[model samples]
Target chain A: MAKKAFNPDIDAPEYKGKYSPYDIIKEGTIAVVVVALLTVVLAVLFSSPDEKAVTIKSWSNATPMDFAATAMTELDGSSGTATYGPPYNNAATGQQVGPLTLAKWMGINVNVNTANDFVVAPLSTLADQPALTSALTTFASASSSRRANWEANYSKGLSSGSFSNGVLQVAAANAGPLPEMLGALTAMARSGALDQALVTQKGFYTTDYTKPLLFMADGSFLANKAQVQHLSGDQWGMMNETGSYPGQAWLWLYTMWYQVPPFSTSWGANADALVWAFMMLLTLLLALTPWIPGLRSIPRKVKVYRLIWREHYKNM
Target chain B: MTTEIDRQWTTRLRKRVVETLPPDKLLPDTQPAYVASWIYVFGVTTLAALAIVILTGCVLAMKGPLWWHLSGTGHFVNSLHLWSVEIFFFAMVIHLWGKFFMAAWRGGRQLTWITGVVLFLTSVGAGFTGYVSQTNYDSQWISTQAKDGINATGGGAFFNVLNLGQMLMWHIVLLPLAAVALTAVHVIYVRIKGVVPPFEEGK
Candidate 1:
């Protein structure tokens, strides 16, 4: 084959000078050992965090009222997942980036009915509970307005309920079958059945935890735990670990934007879409830095490479 | 025989491969003197960390989640996996910074830089999924929080963060496959282009 012509603009500077002996295998071996040693040292110093997953049983046992109240919201179609639009349901308009409702366009692929999936369906599986069974049947047959009325007042009454002695006692009139339904659900949660129940509703493989996690998210259990660990969105939780161990430090640049004015304030529900879009745009800009005029010139203008190759420069 | 060689696709491929990278150039014994830099080591350091990460992850996967949570050896391997991943990202960031500051893309290596950036993005996905597949509170909380951001872009349509099976497959199989392949291409480009020379004085 003939030698190809080299264009100075895109070609590497043709090296006619003396080259230095370099053992790439030796260098690579040293790096592998050094990096592996560093990893072992870090791992020994700080073992990874494995905080016990918050099961529905644990949540219910700890804060029964929160469980009951959230269960009511799920029934009323007012919980976070209940109103979470697209991929879950159509209760609300999904997040939008300016004009593009990408989530809405994606549609309800998960098909979560918070009421059925979170509460009724799980409760329906419980055998030999006539009152609970009756509540499920009545709740199912009742008008949407009547069910909403029942769930609302029960939710309001849940504000003062005492969940002591493994019992939920609320004093809300017109509560109808809710006390029975929620009470049964709370017991189901406390027994650890709800966790399996929520997951089992999806499949036998038991892979997806979306139902249970969504239900738990509606309550304060998950967030409360997160708050103690400084793992909330406000705390740059995306870059956080459970304890003092290192986290996803690469995401700091990404999560930093949320703390500023736009994402934390006016953007509200659309904040996620906007932040995601902005990060993508920034990544594109970073990738294309070689083509961007001032960005590309920064390396030469700053002369950082001169310092990197100082030995060669000194010889020159 | 010479004419027959030209007609064979396999022979043509072999010729093309050798043409692009002859035996000596593919694994050179000498490099440009300007390649001497502490920063230049980071690329290999990142690669080393990734190897450890994969090794630890394979061990963890072999024993399953319950074993990792229960057995002391499993726990240590899990720690190794986590720390190795952290080191991988740490070294990757340093390498990226070093490459950027050195203008490594100068010698028609734009594809190298672009692949690296895409590799970084792929890595972020891999890391995010690893967190989501931990089967612990961190996974639970992260999935819930990340789902909103994910769904906002309809990423949840396919890559449901809450789906542990899906995330585990992606983390272990799909993303790693992509990352390793991209790393190969990136390194091949580096070898082909040679270490980029420093900018000409004052220009």
Candidate 2:
């Protein structure tokens, strides 16, 4: 009789050596019970972190001057939201990866007109006040240069301005109708109407939060809160939890890129795009490790499997 | 003479199933003695954690996001979901490390190894979307920060984290479904392939 050729895929040789009874259901049930008990105990002892959702109402209430100042920035088109480019607007060059213009490639899909969406549109809803109505009309009717001049002067005045009792008191300036419009906008925000207006689209669901977040991010208030919570980009914010709790440790590999040079310091480094692309490559390499010539050899070379199955080898 | 029924699609499928997984192998009551190791336990533990995660997630969905904020019971459920996810990743990483060291991909089981890695990648998406669905300051911050990276790759147009509706659906429906499907495939492959053998000094 001819002997069968060795087939590495076949496990008959290992199966022939020894076998032991294994109750998979019993093992699985015990694991489930242990995990469930652990989850319940942890849940009861340390509920979840439920930091309240930040809204225009909370933000304006917390720092009214910052709110007023941010409104000025929005009108002058100086805020980060105004010049973010692509999905929001096209005022400045966005981040890039190598020679690829990534932000430009996805050009303005969300079509956010920062001035219109962030300030004008939300404020326009409260047209009951004659002063606000007139301000809106005047601001809309002004020439581009005149509007720019008005916004610039008003923005300069805001540096020394103070907010009190729902009113923003700034030094007198040639600011068209900006101050009155902003005052009314502040009242609307204080009443929580601005938050509602920013999100309430023509739909049954009202969950879109782009405008409100953009408004908050342009000012120092939200970033300040984030820094206190250790959620800043430079702080490996993506991998952190709100308080001192466990975070997504699997994300360490992805977040580590942001700490290194080129991603961290290079002016043109589209850290987001570059990091995402690099992660994709890494994930692919991981998925194909068995086929990669050098990588596939590492497992055999390390000889760690010997330790894992040491008992089995000893028995043999 | 062999009949046409011999080549029928169902017959062929049944034959393939039997050839690949005989009943004794598919639902084996006995494992090779080499399977005796503590490291082997992590895989089942990860699966257990996943079950808890999914169960807690379902409870959260039933109550709605706002309800969870107001109710104490909701907080506990939310915590369970969070910690289960934490534990899931913890156990999964250990499982991955153990398997890698053991060269579990040997014996023509490369597909099983690849599926496991793919499942890990899918789970990351599921977890990130869960963060975006939290509807709190963290959600706000994460969505804004994550959008920059996604937009850089031109994914911002479709996968806008700021769109709560999109993220919620992905977290509760789409991504979870994919993760579960990938997991099922991974487990089925393991059943078909059987556990890898211990390495020896020579072939």
In candidate 2, which residue ranges exceed 4 Å CA deviation? A1-16, A267-269, B1-11
lDDT tens per residue, model 1, A265-298? 9986688899999999999999998778777877
Residue range B6-116, candidate 2, lDDT tens digits? 889998899998998788776789998899899999999999999999999999999897778888888888999998998899899999999888777877788888989
- TM-scores across all candidates? 0.96, 0.94
User: What is candidate 1's fraction of native contacts?
Assistant: 0.76
Q: Tell me the tens digit of each residue's lDDT in model 2 across A204-304.
A: 56877777887887888878988999888889888997888767778888988899987788742577888888899998999988777778667668888
- With candidate 2 superimposed using the best TM-score fit, by how many Å does residue B98's alpha carbon deviate from the native? 0.5
Give the CAPRI class of candidate 1. medium
- Alpha-carbon shift of residue A215 in model 1 (angstroms): 0.5
